[model samples]
Target: MSKLEAGIVDGASAGYGAVACTEATKNPVAVANALLEQGPHVMLVGRFADEANKNFGFEVVTNDHFTTPYRKAYWDQTAAALGQRDSGSEMGTVGAIVLDEHGNLAAGASTGGPTGKVDGRIGDTAVLGAGLSADSKLAVLCSGAGDQIFKHLVAANVAKYHVTGSSIRDAARKALQSISATGASCAMAVIDAEGNAAIESTAKLFSVSWAPASGPSTTGLLPTSFPILPTHTIHQCLRNRITVDRALWGGALCSCHGRRRCLSILPLHGLSKEWHPVTSKEKEFHEEYPGYISSNDGPMMAAEKLDGISSRIRAVSGLTAPFNNRFNGPDEDSKLFARIIRGELGQWRIWEDDHHVAFLTPFANTPGFTVLVPRKHLPSDIFAIKGEEFSALMESAHSVGNLLRQALGTSRCGMIFEGFEIDHAHVKLIPIHRHSEATGTTVTVAPFNHHYQGSVTSLNGPLLKGTASLTLDAAELRKKIPVKTITSPRSWADPPRHLSAVLQEPWYKSLFTIQDALFHDSIAFFQKQLGYKYRAAVIQAVAGTTAHLKSLLELHRSSGGKFPRVTVDDALKLVVMNSNDWRYVVESDTSKGRTLTRDGELKLIQHFGGAVWVTEMDHLSVPFYQAFIDDTQAKARCGDLLLGNGEVLGAGERHVEVKDMLAALEQHQVPAQGYPWYTEIREHKPLLTTGWGMGIERFVAWVFQHNDIRNMTIIPRMKGISFAP
Candidate 1:
């Protein structure tokens, strides 16, 4: 074994980034055993830093409890790290090679074999030169089937390619292509003596481009003198013309080969004979793309423009960490307009003026979703982009809107300002397939809220309970609504199911399981989750719950239902909840944000009608009830973990009232010392959960913030002042 890890910490910023380790007891074996336990034999054990909070904790590497029947616990690994497929390709190694500042070269790997193989199973992990190798000249690390890798000495082959003067990226790519031609899946990450690095994976390809102040601009996937590129930052204009050397898609068009969709490349900066990763004015931004997932919409790409730039919403749909007003900090890096005007992240640049530029946005309900922004001025958002600059942008938007009918084969395109993700003042061109789909911010309700059941009415009208939650038992609930699994198109930006209903079209497919889960396994699951005495015996049965939760949440968020994401702590709890708890309602608003506090949970409750709860446990542990409580709609309840000794732990205040647990709780006050997870409504009674809800239209309306989307609800209005216009 390559030295057991002293500790695994994701020190990405500190330069001691995530270290991927593979495992190997010995050689390869094709003695395929029965499906005894072929679960994803992947374990992610590490201390990940919470960057926003500046805290660190050992993230529970959701122990992949099982490999068969596709358990839910398997999802946290995908959410946190590069998600691995669980089926036939379960035999992959985790390895890396390094070339340091002083020219030190070192390589290491750990391997996991196919389901049930012999101990002497030699493959890449056991043999250094197969999965990885490093010498004075170069270092190479790889991940893939060990059998194919060992036989070809894939690592040594890449080194030989490097010795023969092939660029490190090309050398790795060449070796990978050669072996992959034989149909054994493989990918490579490489580094040469000068400390330059490159990576190739079956999942997707990402280009990390940087322009150092003194030396030539560098991109791992690109050559200094333009090379035949497969995937580059897409910057092509909307004119549909395809060429092998340089073609663009997803800014405007897309093509699929087999199951893989090669979503790559932007029109080489300005179509010059030589391709530059960045333009002259982009010297200010330091860029980093730490890999991305390939998807139907496009490669779910991620780009980090650092040194003080406004962070952007990563390509992960519904993930809006980058959508902030962290712009214009009087620093060169903060100048996003300077980079945008210089063609810095542009794709499908159809038209431009002295003051504005129009480009394609990835988040689209229709194919040709585009955006119009000011080029000459740097305004924070729509309110700031005023006077001549705003007028110029509006005029450009009008011109672009006029062309949408012909370009997208739609009757018309509507423009709306959505500042949820991008703080920059830009207008989105929604290609309205239906004339009346666009309805602006209007709140509609289901007319049944316990809070609003009998409330004081304003001069405008009575407070309408647009949505409500009835605490019904499983029997009672099943009688009312049809319960089935719905599979949405794999894009988070696709119109949500509710919105599709608003349009009277079912674009998504609903998957229905003819039966429910096996109750014995389910019983053991809740036992393990609640930490009963027999919990230890149900390890295998309960271990895979996380993957199920991860998948469910991903599907929900991707399908346009509000699924608030969290670290493995609450997420794993949710995995258990999916199996054990009969039905769970993710306490989220129509928009986004979940808080689990009596203190901070007031926002969602006040906005509509809800309640908050906290079941404080040890900060180091995940309590069963805390799972239900932490499922709230606030970013952070911001509490503290404390001991009876009265030492303040993480984030809270302990009153004399908290000493009397039942008394305080009966009055429905609270309890706490930790902040791992929390939620609102009914007390955390064992085996029972009461919840709240609102109209789906109101929630999705919040998600797709647009005014033109009018809904002709079978029933339009009721109590209170419902949106009419």
Candidate 2:
């Protein structure tokens, strides 16, 4: 497994810095893709930093594109706009994207903390396994403080917890609680491909701001309980278009978390459903792509501009990141200056007003999908542009939107302007299926929860599967039907029979008989073994059955009036109050058929070795339960020998200590390969783990030649998947 690699970005003043890790490879681009693709698999801690470039705004580019000075300048400029002074030399953000080329997991991270931060201070972003950790199976991220992260070992601990099967949210909660114990504020997000995730924060003041891979946005201190996605009533505006920015999704913009700044934009429902898994075709061609920036949105500031005057560079280049805001003014001469360099002064029928420019990429083949960029480098926003610029921006957006509808075969289109918020104005025109088309002909109804039995009858007719043959279980059919309940044992013993019974009664199916019979026997066996064991035993009469009569009489003694003061009812009520101890009694006196079903066999083995009355027997073991009764005839012949003497027995058989014959058998040995071979290897493979075992009831029922296990009990069972008979 590859280890984690990390880096730090010191803040403007030095206090706020971001830490990052690129896993398993040195390729920063691969690292970037992996981070976006599989994160927040890596733990993030202490104000994790993420940045997008204005140059690569609408286009999809590899991480290699980020290495250019222009891109770096863009990053620096955006940071400066966020209240940091730019050295105009290099970028401070730290990151790398790499694939698993060497078969080892690797990661790296770096960051410059909060802007205008105090000098010499560091956040959790730079530390390995603090903000990020990478192994073959786990990756994590922390988005809070290094101090809090360290206090709880949030990254590593959350990563480890995730490996153990805790859900991501659960692990996040634990991580947060761990930090909270030390009175530290923490927020984190973890994604483990292992189906575990945890998003949490220690700041009671903390709020969860998350954009789900699917479903709606969430913000606030999430409840530890409930599915990761919460259900709520939604409106149209919040369902059409949205920003890709995670912070914007749930952070300051969420009214749910009491963040009053939640912007009410159209929900990106179409994008959430369709634009996912951006295919090569989708990326290469824009077809009503609702998420990407569109024409009329302004151009991005590629990089931070320097004051140095390079005549040659200035000849071919436009203003850079630090260009004066006046670049967007109605200055025609200034607009013409840019137009002259591009060699398209009115020749290509260009429209310029020192504010915006429109251009179609050489590769752009789709109709109505053009890029709009402002002459000045600034964050793009639908609400920010003014005067002619605003009107021009809208006109451009409308033109493109109409073109998209005509070309993409859609009625209306979605407009999304998400990127370059820190610096540069941009917008996207995305066409989508009309609301009616998307909704389909039928409305979707939620599943019925109350009084729902997972049967077709519980649902509306339209939702039901079949039409010709109404299921007898359907609500309408059942309402007109009469249900017969057997209150007395006699009624159950001799159920009323009729010819129409096959169609009207539920018991017409032979499958029901087999199921009910087996279940009934199993339930009895469970109660006999696990319930008041001293109270009863299932009576069976057999000619060769040793102690058969004696065992019956012994059980009858307990059933008689001279029973112990504290009865089985008391024992059952004390342990399992819901238990019906009376049901454990098996009165098979005149019975011709007695047998145990598969469920009986299973229940016998499970309950016999695990009862309050039997649990204390250390020697008792389940493995032996099958072996002892596996050969009941042999066991019966050497009863006392199997019973005990000086030889101690396993837990379940502890009450029966061996003395003579059994003690002698303890040391006997015979050929290992012989058919009837026998041996007493207690000392070598000591009977330290022995027990009173075997589904004796099942064994008897099986050997007794009964067709069903229910014959062995009083009232047979009628529910559950598997039954005794």
Candidate 3:
């Protein structure tokens, strides 16, 4: 027998084989088996082995069948480059070990001698212990650098270590280490009588698969760590179809039912999915925000609401899992405001102070959109600030605006205050670029058409149809109005002028008598139509005043007169100067004051010539959170930025002191019991905070010079409108 068939054996028989010459025999293993069965010798080789194969009736064939195209190319290239062919060019040796039901073990290895080798050269594959070894206790098969393997007796060493009480893994490692020390590479698979097995290699094993008798089968490259050996007997099978528990290992059978079914046993890192190493850039990001994992495995911090478009900001901890925005309560543990105050949710934070934080909104309505939220869960009303809090809030607003302008290369920023949706006070900032490509060179200053002719007949037509004029003196009407006792001349409030001082002017007296007479008649008209009471008279007065001013400015512009020429700004100043008389009657037992209904307000807005700022409304006319103009608690310390579409932004100071809050609560008729936490903040740790909110859609509409606010929202959420996914 040749060395290729030197040490191979079966459960009840022994065999070995090798290709002896260029045109040798087929079935090398069969020839080796014939030699073992027919002779007293343990092996045979060269011409003698071929003659024995023919004499024993084994089939022989031409050498071309064993010479693959790849081996032939390697032989040619090696001969051309090194002046001689190399034996290493021929690879893909075959080997196998089998255990039968009787507990007998056997192994075999076979390969043609390396291409271009010496005519009589014999390799390790035909040796007893170098390329193949088998006995009752263990079996081993090795491939690679046959001469070196023969010199080191690699397979024999593995069997030696295994028989000497070393584990299959330890024996494999020892054998591999010995081969590596000799400057050679080799790989081997060893199995012991107990069914334990291991494969150790100095080169990649390429592929490995296993199926235990009781679990799913798996296939993949071996992990860098320990191999996960099968717990039950496994036999090599054809066609790569590993069987587990008597069923085919495919589809559902391959899933990890109760145990890990992966080919390699790797660390899982407490995640449901496979662990992946973090990239270098992600590591840097983690270094910048320490304690925050870049992966999706940590405390639940933020989530998208069911609406899909809107998202909820959440606390890093203290919240229940699977957060839902629709189910969240105002004072719930998940409130983002609470965590911001505690400094736990610091990721993505841009700017912050003792009372508030400014961050880039994850659900930005536009580029550079940001949210400035108070750290405390104060009531959703912007008017609830008082004292220095008012000034600080304004300062914060200014700072945010400047930041957006400088960072976003925008000329201005838009602000708004409407907290009807979220019961948290958050101010929205939208960067306003003057030269937006969407609107081009056309800038929309106001959203209404200014086409009314500046004629008394045109302006008076609507006013005359609504009511009959009153004959009361303007001076008498002015005395009946309540004069605020505590007042300060601020930029947002009228310059500390008494109501009487305003009524003393000739122009104010004329406008006051006409506006008052028209307001009463309009009230009568609205009461008769709706059969209910509302402040529709105030709506009519504001609307009429707006029309009248626009007409006067239009007429002046058309006249082309130099002396006493009237401009739109001059007309607006006239309206602001006469604001002292912008009042409506409040009947006894009704609310302290009233403003126009939403629909009525919208109607009045259509008449405005341009943007206008109104301030110092009646204290009871607004929410109790608005700070009082003074200790008298008569007027709210708030201002509204009204556009042709209605109030787009609102700024206000909040009540910081307990007494002031209690007094304002009583004046506005809101019960203190309903706001226990809000009351406690004022009682224990009052903060002087002020801020403003702006509607993102309205701001974008204003910036882009669009008349329709709906166009501004990419996914518009209008009242009474439903959208399908």
Candidate 4:
């Protein structure tokens, strides 16, 4: 026999029994018999019990096999109704009491333990005297609530009564009475040395039978008072079906399957007849506004119109309440924009007009952080506005930047126009402090200083007379500006790092490298000529291009040995680099050779040293609101302020003509239906104007010399993914 079986039997024998059983095993009766033959020991549990059973040659079954249909049904009903399994019930056990002619008496109990009992539970059935007891005078077996039976030592007490000279019947009855006093119920049968037997129970007992040596066996009354496991609840049955379906498919069951099955089973008590994830009106609202509310319309108001939209409304509202709800309505007192317009938000207001307002952000990461918001309700995407309103919006943003610089005691500021959290179009202005504060954390900033060049020269005019001098001798340029080599080895596929490849990386890294290299050269050249830092040195020039300048530069290396021979007119039309895709390269002559690359022997050159302003951008590269420079439609009246690391600000004059707006819209492929109001405003009350915005984080990072923009925001939201607070 296994050590565990031997131990159980030995322990039972030591406690006045010759046999024992455990419901934890597949064949409890067989295990009991094996233990009885194996000899004494106490308990075995968990993995140790399993090992013992294996060694004793007892069949082992999976835990699931022990869950009878009745037990599972009962568990389902109880858990569905009560949200927890019943723990007080006593069931799923059996035992036997025997008397041999040799005057030997034995009692044993076997059980699968309590139904729904947690793993590793050792019940009274395994606790020798608690469930079974035997002596020369009598043998007793008891079954019921394991905890109460174990506490009362029911079997042993009955045996003790018999050994002390009480009749078996009287002893069993008294033991039961003792258990009843404790508010516990149990059933028991007792056998004396004379072969007489008595059965007694405070609770209903299972079937009872007896047979005489010289007579046929007869079955006695079976208890009918015990409650049968209740039928499984509808919710329980539905859950069971879903579980089975998921197991069969090895994936999520279709939501429709659940709904259909549920509907067939019972009525959906709280759901409406017309249920939809998103109703027709909600879809229309989304199509029109995309990311902003229209007028006084909102999700709550929309939900009231739909039969089953409340639940979805609650779900979405719960997730976005902290951010989106703050800008729900123009007159909402809780809205930051509304409070700011009312002069109730922020430390101070910076600027305001009939159509816009600006103020310092209370949760500023930097000393002079400000937010510029439109006075009128507007969508988060500025492109949703049309004609002069777009231009006016840009102008307002530009004014905010200027105001922030003056207010914060700095000549430079960074602005960012992004609708990250709210639905309204807001621009953030971050002042570019000249020097880092002593108490502030370390940050990265652009090393190159800006010397503002005079007014932007018209690119449509002839090239400057000294334009040829701008292309310095490669060998001479190298002597003035030392170029860093790509020391890392490269394969055929991975060529030496070029300006084009460098431009593909994050703007901060690549742009800084280019700016630093050019700045060093410019500083050296000007210092040699002036014998000091030429703070006022500024060079401005205009070059036109017939083809897209950006595309021309990208294809320079592949365009054979010759630079694309451009006519004077081609050079005049500047190809605006929209987004972060544009690359600027200069052909330079070094000690090794002449090459067109960012880090090649010939260094890159900027028309203006400090902040270069370039206008007349390619029409296709800019937004629809940007007005065409002329009827030719080749260039738009848009420009960028190349300051700090790179272009820190962008401004564009908006198109006032409805026809031009339509054409621009077609070029950009924006759905026209969604912009009906914007189109109406453009056609009716158009105003010719311009606007610009700057990135606050980028500007602050540039001023503080911080490489990462993420460090600039207190609760940074990255690519729409938020982290736990």
Using lDDT as the measure, the top candidate is 3
Residue-wise lDDT of candidate 1 within 523-548, one digit each (tens)? 53433222111222121121211222
Worst 10-residue lDDT window, candidate 1: 27-36
Error of 3 at 29 (Å): 1.5
TM-score of each: 0.25, 0.22, 0.32, 0.29
> How big is the RMSD of model 4?
39.5
**Reference-based TM-score, model 4:** 0.29
- lDDT string, candidate 4, 1-725, tens digits: 11111112222244432223333456655544554566353445556556556778888766676566786776788767767655655465566777777777777666655555554555677666777777676777777777778877888777776666667776776566545534355778788778888877654334577776678987654331211101111112213431111001111122324332121111113323442221123211221111111111123322223322222322322322122213324565455566656656423454556677665544443444567787766765566687787899889877767665554456656555444345567766656665433322111221221221211110112212221222233224334443232221111123344323333533334334434534465753543333222221111001111112223222442344223332112323334222232322222412211111222101111322233444565665566678877887766787655444555567888878777777777766787777787677888877687788776655544443445555444334555454323
Which ranking of candidates, highest TM-score first?
Answer: 3, 4, 1, 2
lDDT of 3: 0.50
Candidate 2 has its poorest 10 consecutive residues by lDDT at 637-646
* Candidate 1 Cα deviation (angstroms), residue 118: 5.6
Model 3 regions more than 4 Å off:
1-7, 10-22, 113-118, 206-725
